[model samples]
Target chain A: MPDSFDNVSVSTKANVYFDGKVVSHSLILADGRKKSLGVIFPGEYHFGTADPEVMEITAGACEVVIDGTTETRAVAAGSSFTVAANSGFTIRVTDSPCEYICSFGTP
Target chain B: MPDSFDNVSVSTKANVYFDGKVVSHSLILADGRKKSLGVIFPGEYHFGTADPEVMEITAGACEVVIDGTTETRAVAAGSSFTVAANSGFTIRVTDSPCEYICSFGTP
Candidate 1:
């Protein structure tokens, strides 16, 4: 995974969610792919996706339960998870904040 | 004034502050200037700076009192506040979250 993205366009304003418990900055890559860099505080959050998405954890850890699944996977740093289009997942972060890069559109 | 920045490098990880009350993503401009896109939850935060900074509000609002100053300026969207080097400022956000683009190094 890349530590930083070069030759991209990023929004000045942030996408704030759950009263700032989660915040992200949107950016478009040179190839026109949209992604978001975000931080999730220690809490449980459920997010629905309009398109298939890949979430890569960059820092800290989280527990994820994908929709229609009973398994709760413990995801650590440098790990990733995929969610189906139009589906959702519940993520819980403990100990500290979890940072991630969410790639939208396709898994 | 620009909603988005073109041709830049952005970090995948975010800077979390005040136990996630404030979150920011760092990026570098084409000219090598450093900036951060951030959101501030409804709270008061005091930050010390090594370099002078210009904080431009992109969404919502905040009240700021620069270090050693008594005036509390109400800054809204499209407004900005400058902090001197080796100094700091106390920012308060009430009612709603505040979004800002913080430019570092110079005013």
Candidate 2:
């Protein structure tokens, strides 16, 4: 079993995002840190976030174009990347559905 | 936005199960409800649950064989089914990778 957090609660939202290709679930910890588990489908999508995010790819592969970057990085399962607050990124899901855990840092 | 559980916490275990096709993360609710979010690859898998399980398909499609049942049920996104405690079930992933939230009830 993975690290068990037998001390907290969670909530899930159905059919999130306007494109219907993404869904998110909320994981509330006792310490007040906030994070989300997101499932993204195949296609090119752009996302902007107000909080700095650490996106960990738990499954599938995709190409990410971070804001202000000229090159794209191909990330697969077990890899991760970071994006600054108030910035954005573009993800191209050409191979498979991507499952990720997006953790937001405290400002 | 989906239901936000900003008051609780969760822990995730990476690369769970022996088959390598199924990975599970642990979600600990404030009420002590034990559930898991699982990602299953394309194939047939048989699973046994220690407690009664309500399996909700959050993404993709598959066929499920509830133990002691004669016919299979085709489940897609937003659908769910139940498996009794201490019993087993078989899931056939024919079309795509399946993401599910499995909630286990108290015995």
Q: At residue A31, what lDDT does model 1 achieve?
A: 93
In candidate 2, stretches whose alpha carbon ends up further than 4 angstroms from where it belongs are A1-6, B1-33, B36-51, B54-102
Query: Alpha carbon lDDT of residue A103, candidate 2?
Result: 80
Candidate 2 second chain TM = 0.87
Best by lDDT: 1
Candidate 2 residues B1-107, lDDT tens each?
12333333456533345334665556655666766666676789889978899988888988999888878999998899899998989998876668787888952
* Number of the predicted model whose TM-score against the real structure is largest: 1
State every prediction's TM-score relative to the real structure.
0.96, 0.58
Instruction: Indicate the docking level reached by candidate 1.
Output: high
DockQ of 1: 0.91
TM-score of 2: 0.58
Clash tally, candidates in order: 0, 9
